[model samples]
Target: MLNGLGVWDIFLTLTTLTRGYLIWKVVNLLTRSTTGSTNVYQEICGQWVQTNTLTMDNADWGTFVRYAHRVKSIVIHNDSLFGNCKTIDVSILRALSMPPIPPASILFPQLRQLVCYDRRDEIYPFVRLLFGPKLTKVDVRLEASRSAQLAVLPSLAAWCPSVKKAELRVWRERPLGAGGINEVRALSDVVCKWRHLEQLSCGVGCLDDKAILHLGKLNSLRSLQLRISSHLTYHSVRQAEHGPLFQFLDHIHMVAIDSLSSCTSFFPLFSSLPPNITISPYAPYRSEGLCDLFTDLSVHESSGVLEDVSVEDHFQSTAPEEVFTIETLRPLLGLHRLRILSLETFYSFSLDDNALKEIGSAFPLLAELSLTADRGSNRHSKISVNGLITLLGLCPHLTSLSLTIDATRVDDIEPERRPGGGISNLNIDTLRLNDSKINHPRIVAAILFDVLPYVDVFAWEWGAHFDESDAEIYRPRWVEVQALLGAFRTVQEWRQPGFLPM
Candidate 1:
């Protein structure tokens, strides 16, 4: 067992063991030095700390004062921990009451962005400190309180003079012209005084004639977002005529605005302005000429002011054929500058070739498109994937597409089950299809072969009967589908490492 003598062999074995221990000690010392140079917790903790954001509900007055001194921005949202009240009790009030904290500058010298819930009018004086020359943005939500000091507008404007940009949602509209004139005058003064004011967004609880008149006086404003109910009448239109409201607008975002009856109502005033206008599909006003009153504005046809448009329509107790027709989408197709288009709550009158063609050609610059059909109580006609492929042919530049089809009908006791045949023609990189009733390997294979011949990635939701384990058995079918398109031979090209089993 030894090279020459047993004692020599034992000495050699002991020498090797001692060398191994020395190597282990050197590795441990090297690891310690590396760790000392980099501490992961410091990076993580530093990321969590912000210059000036506080959970006022969870923080005390002393804590707020300490952080408020460095805070340049503050955002306070309704939190369950804070008792979920619309209004938060600012620690600033408590701090102000305490042993005359050195001047407010000592407590909050750089705080600028203040976002608060509409608590009451009495909080105005306390808020004034945060709205000095340093303030740039203010977001406040208003609630109805009859006895609050801020029950009127003049008091609010007078309390805060340095608000440059403001977003307010009030419980009721301020009276304009004669009755709300004093409040309007105060607002006018505030607007005039804030030379740097650029954006004003207001959601009125009640938009009356006087309110529109008061809003017309904001000539210096560059961007305006208004949300008012459909109750605004022709009388209110008369009030908007006294002063030009849309003259200086370069950008406009409108929501829940049902009162604007037609382009004639507001566009005539802004004849000289070339503004990028956007209207949320939830707006109440239904366009009289918008293809059978579907309540959508066609950006292609409209002076290109509304560049991107999304349509959401709901039909009441009517058949899909009766609700949506080729004529219904005429206004949408007319939109010119539409680069992104999404149609939700789509009710097709019929899945005819003409209907598909009209929709496909509606948006030329569209790179992303989503069409969602509603699954209502009434039965809906099934749409073939081939029809979608045909649509893709019309939209040549499309890179991403989403289609949600619901073919379930109430009358049928048993639905006919058929394989999903592949779609041919057209080139698209990304596709999402939601089908609940489809699941034949041959059917899926045939469909994928026809559509995604060169597709690198494929994402599909399994039909109702499939689960995780079934994917292994059905995976061969997927391979078959790709094989038909010559994709199987190039297996290395496809990389979907973790697919949810069929």
Candidate 2:
């Protein structure tokens, strides 16, 4: 038997090569035979981490380089790396830069898209390793100061010059003092180089007055979504002298706007915006502010060409002064091409029977109308059940409807006699009613049975909408209404010409 230094020599020589060969074989099987397909999309998570440069330091990287060649997308989504967290998707990229990999031996040479997420903003510094000339899309979310998030932009433009789509969100922004302004400047500079950037989503803080002005001039930008901050109000934008703003824009979104002032400040800047627009604000808006917003739209070149315009989240405020009156929404009535109009708020609209009739006549082609108010929002005179029926009859094209109706006086309001049921909302498929103050259940159900006889789905807010007392009293009435609808529907089916007893 061999002894002494011969045994130790074998251990030193064989053990090093054995460890490297074992790691290499495991990685090969994962990307090759294990999946039973060679074309599988690879991710940098557990098992994947073992092939990272740190694990294979000074060993062998031929197997890794072979696998990394086919990777077109790289995703780093890890929650907390400090614990023994099972999801290790966030670790590989951060460790890919050390040792044996070498500085210039680029991995992921064919990478085109990079999606990375970190709660602490640590993974992105190593994200550059995944960037290549062919990269077209980058979506990153990190938690850090505004300046730190802006720093990633410079690297993106440096590596992925022709990126067509970019979504960058920076959460938990700390106080930046004067440094914040410089970060905005940096964002403007970096994006100006993104000659092919067609769609962009970022925080409003990243696009100040000057930055937005430059962005509008980008001919390639078609869709833009700005996540607005309540604290930031854009008031300094002006018409660019060299060219028209957002000339070729097809879609525009202004989301998370906490104030009406924010909407007015930004919407008026563009000479003409996209026909289909989405403005979702988290806070309540006064009637006057909304009126001003629509008035601004009325003058824009896009208003005449507009079809669907939805201002979400901002609803009728509980305060009497904040309610949307017919006059407040008068500007929208002129948009003849408008098909879908949604203005659901927390409270109630001040529009009455006359207003609904006018709206129906104005937009006769309307298909979807959502004017639903929150529960217990009876501060104003709501449209009666008959008023809703008239509006539905006028707009035969209506398919989906969500609104608040007063069915309290369903019996006395209309005593007209009918045959089997009320006029059928034939084309209507979806219906949502914010039931309030309904003393008579049978009459209301009978009336609804006549109107909406063939609804595909009926949306009703139950326990979530009421207090214990409200639920106990009002729930049974609504339940009775639903049961009556079913009974009435059964009779209608029997009345059909080809009905069989079975």
Candidate 3:
């Protein structure tokens, strides 16, 4: 209970940057520890979910007011907390229309960061109260109508003067042209006030030719995410006045760009690239479009420094894009520093042993590679078990691997029997095989043990997309391979006393 909160604990909470939090999460959005549930959705975090609403009686409020000066961060959910709040102190309801609410009355006066969800009109009063003078960061998700959303933008700018990092997620507030132009202009006005903003996320509508040049001038911006409007086209960003656009950026994520041309044009507007990039389009592009996009990406000055690239879609479209063909992907061959390359689509790669070796040799430091495609045949790729051996030999640092391999024949010159002998990759811990043909389970299992002795995540198709015939043919064999891997793990653990568990 809040009754036990003391000035000493408050001191520690502010000094150590830990204890001052509402609900469960602290300052970090996703900590990725045992308490984090973001990476694995099924992970249960019941203990952390103590209460969404911070309740207080008259005595509790009195005690809370004592240590309020030390509270540094707060996270709130609008579903039941701030929007429908009924138990908060009445001092919050009185919104004084001044720049900084006098220190004598500011609620959580020392609060520096706020993460809140907005759904209704009830959040407006709490925003006035919660937006402390020292707030430097704000992450808001607004799911209200367009009119209601526009009404709150001006208030945020007037209140949160010190905010350096902001994320505004507008969810279905209004249609693109349905009286949204004015709201978009208001957002741009609010954004211009944040001159020192190191990170920002909002709709692409806030960035026009002028705003792009303005944002480019701020060298502190390192990360950016823009949710493209459905009405966006290549022409929308064509008029961007070409200056230093996001040259200091280290990470960028472009989400919901549906068309092929729109995504391509978006890249060239920024001549420099962030080391980490993610392009998530609602629809898949054709092979030529992918080639063109890569061409645009390759012309940049920092292309060699690019470390991670993920081009993914929710579902495989019946587009004409050729999957991972050597000819089509030649533009990306110069990204020698690439460590993570994940291309997820429900199609096969046009990869043979030679293409595979060439690609692997190009990215020598690749640590995690995922080309996990769910398709019917291995005809597009001729990389049998031996080919995998060659690929693994090339990529010595690959730890997590997902590929569509032709595992039909299990013939490999045993590492002991090769000309100079072969060395199996011991770095791989997660192995996910695409829907490739597997005729021999025992041999394949042994081959896998030889290739990736430490593979803990053995992934095969377990989705509802399979037909009865396909399931009957492939499921049991892979299941046997899994069983064998378990037995092999048991035997290996007995031999090597310090290996990580599978």
Query: Poorest 10 consecutive residues of model 2 by lDDT?
Result: 21-30
Candidates in order: C-alpha RMSD to true structure: 16.0, 8.7, 7.8
Q: Candidate 2 on 402-482: residue-level lDDT in tens?
A: 776666856445466651235567777567765454678888887776777776323346313334575567657777777
Q: State how far residue 33 of model 2 sits from its true place (Å).
A: 14
Better of 2 and 3 by TM-score: 3
Q: Tell me, by TM-score, which candidate is best.
A: 3
Which candidate model has the greater lDDT, 1 or 3?
3
lDDT of 1 by residue, 356-444 (tens): 66677776667767554443201232445445555766676677776532222212211253222333434565555433223454444
- Off-target runs (Cα >4 Å) in candidate 2 are 1-62, 74-93, 97-99, 103-106, 144-149, 173-179, 227-240, 255-259, 282-284, 314-321, 379-381, 412-423, 435-450, 453-468, 479-502
**Which runs of model 1 end up more than 4 angstroms from their true locations?**
1-69, 80-109, 117-126, 146-164, 171-197, 204-223, 228-251, 257-264, 272-302, 311-322, 343-351, 371-374, 377-383, 399-403, 406-502
lDDT of candidate 1? 0.45
Total clashes in model 2, counting residue pairs 3 or more apart in sequence or in different chains: 3
Where does the lowest 10-residue lDDT sum fall in candidate 1? 21-30
